[model samples]
Target: MVKIKANYVLAALWITLLCSCQKRSPEIPEIRQVDVLIVGGGASGTMAAIQAARMGSSVLVAEETPWLGGMLTAAGVSAIDGNYKLQSGLWEEFRKNLYNHYGGPEGVKTGWVSNVLFEPEVGDSILKYMAGLEDGIELMLNSTLGHIEKTQKGWIADIAYQTDTIRVETQVVIDGTELGDVAALVGIPYEIGMDSRHLSNEKIAPETANDIVQDLTYVAILKDYGKGTDMTITKPEGYDPSPFYCTCAGRCNQDSIGRKLWDCEHMMGYGRLPGDKYMINWPIFGNDFYLNVIEMAPHERKQAYEQAKWYTMCYVYYLQDALGFRHLGIADDVFPTADGLPFIPYHRESRRIDGIVRFDLNDLARPFAQTNALYRTGVAVGDYPVDHHHAAYPQSEALPDLHFYPVPSYALPLGTLIPKSVSNFIVAEKSISVTNLVNGTTRLQPVCLLIGQAAGALAALAVDEGVSPADVPVRKVQQALLDSKAYILPYLDVSPTSSSFSAIQKTGATGILRGEGKNIGWENQTLFYPDSLVSKSALQTGLQDIAAGLVITSKKETLTVNEALKVIYDLMKLRPGDTHFSSREAMDEKAKEIWKNHMDTLMDPEVSITRAMFSVLLGELIDPFSNWPVDHHGTYRSGIN
Candidate 1:
């Protein structure tokens, strides 16, 4: 009888243990639905989330690192590069915040390498503050994405955060991850490293394609502790000072009157940040390490990153031991890492997606002459020249001299952000579809921020309209960017603060009054010449492209107010078949009715119309961009006229 009771007790104990194990198996992670799920909260990803949230889309940003900014903060490249005169949208907002934090523009200009420089921590705090203001954004730091699949409605992804797995159902996905990891995870076709001349048709590209990416820098931020401080760290492994001997040797600057400013002080001041901090990211012979970790597994990448970190530590030791700058020590309070280095490396290249349109060097060299008017669909702009760091590679000698091909300031096309096959995917970071040559300019911080803003707008519009990102109207995206004080056209003279900013942007995108671009020194310029007079031929040519079957009877060389008004009347009557305006008299009366709506001054019929006035009149009245619909390639669709 006692043996029978023992058997029953053992059976009951087994049943209880089994039930407990089943209960603790981690209940399949509750589904969290969002309108947009942005992977990687880097520079572009952060801007994308904020922009999407502002557009009324519930956004979830999954970042692998704890900090928000990628290269700008987490990677410790806090010095701003390019787009100095072309501050638009979130870039401008971020800069203004820096100015406020540091007491103005002059305060942050402690470094000679860039006009804007700050500590990485400050940049992160500002970005976090900016993101916090938006209520729709759910930023998950130290989070990673896993197991994403496309569904008929949208996408479903599993996000791992703090020992918990959260399933996300998102309408649109933005690949803002460093090295384009999210796109790679989703099986998006992408190209890495150098492209052959035949592939890109770029004059500067090498004849043969190779998997040679730019050298990544493991940045170290050093602070001036005190005059007699001995903050020198122990010597790192492989501490040969031969590779760094030429680091202080100045580089040849073609823009600086062909002078090479060689000095140790100049090298130290290159990335000098505010508050007596130094950004040790010297590219020449410094800490730029060559490693393509894009395709590596997580553990493999972690191991490779350790080597890069050691290489940077060697450089830091060289500065202290050899150069005798012992007062400057690693900024311990900057990052949370144990080694006092950045959370990530400053990746200069990524997996360039095979997007709907592939931007090349030819597009930047000649924007208006392209077979497809890609410039018309521009969503982001960059002015930085084509810069590549290949000193570490032996094969770099076979490549063409990139500095020989000077490109003007250019805008990035909207199609470059949308993958050709992905339904609702958008690429925001350095991974956007561009030739290896063009990625040099687009990969900068300011351009990446603007690209992120554009990506957010595209994703939000796609979710709101229940359409794919490729199907969203090009002009609608541009309009949304302009509404947010961003630039679609790279007009150096006309800033976002101008009252006629939207007017000029709309007209410029329509290819009506084109801006002239110039590559003078490092500062590339595209001037609208708002004060210049609008010639009759230019006006007629622009009108013909949009308003088909319209006749202009103007004989004068330049267009006056009366002549411009006549052309507008003719275009109105031809297209949309405006029955409200029977003749020039009726059209003029209607124009007068809406004159106060667009202009601040009274009507002056005899005054010659300037380019600015003409753009304003046509952009407000005709609205050619609205009627002209464009495809993903920026080519006009048929049957629109």
Candidate 2:
């Protein structure tokens, strides 16, 4: 009996040991389910996270760096580029915040290069504050992408932190990375460096594809030396000081204009930040690393990154050593890095995805009348010139043909964000499907933010509808963007001086044009009477002119609420029994009968109407799905699409 008891104890101890060993081994990664997973925490990533969270989705944002704003903050390029006057949506919100933070709008306009400029830290704080407003968004800072696998249900990404890994399963994934890393990892086809002219059909594209890409820069934020401070930086390993003194902006560069070295401006520019500091992103005779990091291997990329930093350091050293700017040192308090440089290089080129629509220079050069469909299909708007940086590089004879000018403010289509072969995925940042020439403009901070917001909205809508993001209709996406107050159309520039400017502004939100009145019956008299009290027939005709499809006409003094409801009912084809009017449903009640009676009372043609009432009615007629009864829910504008 004793021996048997001992044997049982020994067996129990062995079992306990085996269990301990199993527990010590690695366990399955924690599976976290989310509606959207946004990779890259730059300008687009932050915007995407906020937009998706606002749309009632659980979003997980994994950023490789600690900062949220990529190019705007972490990359040290704080000077906002493009979309200065056409700001709306989150872009407008951010700019407003910046303006308020610095006392007013003039605070941000401290530099000549851009309309808005601030310290990188200011942008970082604002983005963090914005991210905090969304409870559904989980921002994972200092997290890197370990691995990713696509499943039929969605995508699974392994997010590795210090000593643990979290597996994120999301229905939609947005590749907002600066380099399109996620797209490449997921086997999506993309183009690196410059594309051939024959393929992109960009007038500026090269005849053959080349490995040469735009130069990458390590932007420097320098404070004025007159602030009673003295500093010095260590000289870079490569001490070559010859190329740093040349005139590269074509103003004095003899290679272009046959001028002496002293003819060009210095390789520096005014900073947009406070305290009159200077932002040194100068590509002329400065640190523009000519290597193509996107096409490089792991080892090669690291080498290039290190060399770029060294070049920037060399430039800084020259400022103090050669140029006699002893007080102008690196802003130690700005960047968190030990060397006072940005966490990442300013990558001007990335592996652009082969999206459903590849926007080129033609998209920017052509007028909206010639491409109305394309204009109406735009999801974002910008008017930046096609400014290419390769022109400043060595052996860049092709640069002359590559640069373009007078690029008008144009809209970017939803198709530009959708990958041709991939579902449940979208791209933001420079990785968007734009030709190498067009990328110069589309890659701007404001445009990338718009793209990010659009991608986020599409992802959230897809998750809500249980459909792929690519399946969501473009017009529906446009509607959501419009509701978000994004400026989607740039063609109808309404001047405040016009009597119909306010009406045009409102109606243009729905893609309507303020029509020009024509002479009727050969009387040579136009009926567009601005500042006159509008009649019922005139209002209806104006609606029709704006293409609202309302045909009811009357010469009555006042338009009744019933007439508006009837027009809406006719245009939307909403029967008496739709969910839109389900609020009237009760126990044993005829909801359709109630709706018909209610609409009849609301549609009485004799009720007097005001201009504000007309505007509200027009808003409802254009978008029947909107919750129209709420106070101030009506969109102000001419009804148009």
Candidate 3:
């Protein structure tokens, strides 16, 4: 045999490997099916899964990371933003549970940046525990979406779990990922970076679309080192010292509004958390990544993430060696990484979908409630200011035009969650269709959580109704959310803690919703008596307290259905000879005309009324707005305006 030269042998091996790669077969993905499939396990994804599971649907939650909380835990942005007192539904439950965990609400206010604060690990554990209690939810950590295809049965998504691949079929799919990855992978039309001023009609938007987005930060947790401690951080390779612009205490040192004095400060910013730990998320001096992570290849994205961590490491080095804060060090137990840093970046923007309804600056300007029909369908509420973080990065020339302003407490419409062309899909969190200016406030943690909860509820309702998410009636979704004890309107004083809150919330448009209950003489004190079985006598008394004309002198224990109908007819001044009455055998043309113009229904003669019926009847009679009450056989039907 003739021996080949070393170079020739190496070249032959490389050619063989290339040919073998081209001939290899693609791997097959395993299949699994569920009623609802959620692609992210961040703040919104967790809430989406919980709500869907709560609605008797089998939910599959696939998270890329092991921990649950997104910005709050893995990203280490533990400071909760906006809607502190307006917490409703699952959010209220979360706050209550957090309070109980910390022993009281006072204990949760451990930091100055937010009214409520807790350790990142504490929040992560709480979310995990809550998900664990739901039997319908199957959570798969360390899994990521690979490829998604739409099907007649809804949709199927290929998920990658390290070396293994699984295909998931779902009736409803919610895109709650931090960066809107599901929407992008499924071919949904979406926008990345800043939108145009004319397109979104937002005053703060630029004239044209810019690839610049809000800067992301690799937040760090610093523990108090004893006095005179001398720990030093090594300088990271390829670090840019010119970008660092902040002193340690940026919060108190800088101006509160408009452009800040400097990017960094010398004092601890945003105050501290419990256990003597300080959160270092100051935008001025902190390590903020100005590059766009969306639409990046895997290797490019990984390199960007590494750059962010390296920048933060450089900042830590500055804090300890340069700033003379030798006493401060990275929290040893906060994160599992080698240097004890957070696992991910706190992302501020995502690939926003082209939704059925687009929220703009005008929607957040307070007058859109009456002018826009979609605005009336308020599903989530937020009150955060429009915050943009572009001044810190010099390379992001287009981002400096963004400015902050106070946004009114506004409701997000259900249309924002529904995509324009996609079926059986919903996008929550920062992915919802809104202008860049509106996203400033809507991207807050509280609003995102509510959106996630509503998305889940909407998905569950769609699955149950055998309809697409877009086909579900807005009012029905609102009613389902209301029934779930969600606070649609923030004007109400009573929360879910009130016994009759759900009933009162549902009847708000009918002008029958009341605050504290009126005192009935029989009761020990004034109360709604929501749970007590109501009798006819009690309803008559309630009617007297509400309607001035529907007074009944004879108080019977339980009046027959006929008596109730007769009482309502008498109050409306209708007589038996009227065409509405079955006794009108020889009604004249004029009498028939009167009955035709004012249609009403009559109830059964002998059945007793329930408490719900009594409340409805009482509400119709005492119309504060002086609107006509449509009578469906004396069944308290609300009249059309």
Worst 10 residues of 2 by lDDT: 627-636
What's the residue-level lDDT of 214 in candidate 2?
A: 80
TM-score to native of every candidate shown? 0.92, 0.75, 0.74
**Which candidate comes out best when scored by TM-score?**
1
Ranking by TM-score: 1, 2, 3
**Backbone collisions counted per model:** 0, 11, 17
lDDT of 3 at 72: 79
Better of 2 and 3 by TM-score: 2
- For model 1, the stretches where C-alpha displacement exceeds 4 angstroms are 1-25, 250-261, 547-552, 577-582, 593-599, 638-641
Tens-digit per-residue lDDT, 388-449, candidate 3: 77755666554535545655566677888989888999998899988877887788888888
Q: Candidate 1 overall Cα lDDT vs. reference?
A: 0.84
- Tens digit per residue, CA lDDT, model 1, 312-350: 999999889888899999998889888889999999999
